[model samples]
Target: MSFSKIFGGKKKEQAPSTGEAIQRLRQTEEMLNKKQDFLEKKITEELKTARNKGTKDKRAALNALKRKKRLEKQLQQIDGTLSTIEFQREALENANTNSEVLKTMGYAAKALKNAHQHLDVDDVHDLMDDISESMDVSNEISEAISTQPAFDTVDEDELLAELEELEQEELDEKLLDVGPSVSDRLPDVPSEAPAHREKAKKVDDDDDMAELAAWAS
Candidate 1:
């Protein structure tokens, strides 16, 4: 029978063979490894050139060093990617059955997704640095605000006025307690009555003296 007729007269859709998938992953890993190797070599060559140039063109040398550093960072990332791919391929190969293979594949896919989603170390460091600086600035602002002087509602003039009024009230209360009222003023003294009494007494004394003298003579 023809191959199609034997399989219900239709060509069945085939799943990717595990061996083929592992081979493809290995090929991709090898390519990444080659890229990483190239970048490393380029970085090493640039560093050597920078060192040989010495301090003559310091700015150029510094820029070359920076470029080398960037290349090295990229190389490291490529190496990590290759290693992860190789690991995943090995894991897929070791799965016992189809179900296990599927599970492993799913896990590998999820891990790749997560790797893509994760922030780079440099980004995380920069974010943390920014947050720290912001906190420091906020603290400084708060301290400055706390140290600033507060506004006073009553000034010196107003305070002195209130004090003067209180003193005046106290003095008035004391004067009222110590001083006499209008009804308690001294009474008027007798002057004419004393003169009249002296005159009357002198007249009586003169009459008595006359009578006595007449009798003696």
Candidate 2:
């Protein structure tokens, strides 16, 4: 049998895409909303008619109520239809989301595979080892460059002791220089302030400073 005959001479109809299905459902919902509004208006009008004709025209009032009942039934059916469409649309959206996520995951897997094609675990380890060894060699070279100069040949203990002695001498000179200023400041000392005792101590300090200076010179 020919292929066309095997399939009843008809091409299979393709199902709608998710997007198209959702859009169609939305359109149907809009149309149903309009239809619901129309039915509600008709029912309201029939109710008004029945109310206006109430005792004066029994047959007309009954007819109006019957029409209202039919319009209300149609409105209920449209509400049910709207609910069904909303449920279907939400389901389609979720399916589309899952499909896109799955597609992206597949693409990422392919990319990861391609990226690792030229890379080997052993080669990576070897590269890292070479880098670490080079860093160690560079650190050694830096240490050699920054080693202490010829100053290391000198005695640090002797130099430090001499430095301390020089600092002490400078401090003594400054103290002697300040004595004259101290006397000038206290020209009129109070009697009970032990001014004579302070003067004796200053004289001894001056004598000791003079002897030290003469020895150094």
Candidate 3:
């Protein structure tokens, strides 16, 4: 007979969970409601008895009315009990819902923690720095390839000067080509058409005068 065995010998009774408690409360409400219905039926029967016996037997009708009144009191008690049970049941149901929600939230928090376990701010920063360095190297390589020795870079001012010189040479050549043709199409400097026309008229007048003098002679 040890003292520990005597004191801790009985196993404790486990309390009902929120869901179980709510179910019990609902069962109690249903039972009270059934009892209330039974009471109402009995009251109706008592009222019918009183109505039937009222005229023929007054004493019997009084007794029936008294029974009806007692039945109504029982029915009112059941109504109050049912209201209490229903309120308790709803409260238990809300508690159960909140408990489940808390459990789900706790599980979600744990999952999120596990997912981010291997990630740190320093690791993220290092990864971003590596990406930026790689990008910089890539840009440098592209610039080097674009500006290779195989490609020649011409000065903009020299190119403009050469273009202007070519335009002037083309203009001078066009002027030279047109100069001889335009000169060849021009008339001679001295004109002889008027002098030749006056000489012919004078010769015709002298011939006409000589004919007239011969006729006179």
Give the 10-residue window scoring lowest on summed lDDT in candidate 3.
146-155
**For model 3, what is the error of residue 33's alpha carbon versus the real structure, in angstroms, after optimal superposition?**
2.1
Q: How many backbone clashes does candidate 2 have?
A: 0
lDDT, residue 9, model 1: 77
Question: How big is the positional error of residue 132 in model 1, measured in Å on the Cα after superposition?
Answer: 91
- Residue range with the least summed lDDT across 10 consecutive positions in model 2: 178-187
Selected candidate, larger TM-score, 2 vs 3 = 2
Residue 123's lDDT within candidate 1 is 96
Listed in order, each prediction's TM-score against the native is: 0.37, 0.66, 0.65
Once superposed on the true structure, which residue ranges of model 1 sit more than 4 Å away at CA? 1-15, 96-217
* lDDT value for model 3: 0.89
lDDT per prediction? Answer: 0.86, 0.94, 0.89
Q: Pick the candidate with the highest lDDT.
A: 2
**Candidate 2 lDDT, 1-217, residue by residue in tens:** 8988987787788999998999999999999999999999999999999999998999999999999999999999999999999999999999999999999999999999999999999999999999999999999999999998886688889999999999999999998877566557776857867988899999999999999999999
Model 1 steric clash pairs: none
Which tens-of-lDDT digit does each residue in 23-122 have in candidate 3?
A: 7888888888888888888999999999999889999999999999999888888888888888888888888999999999999999999999989989
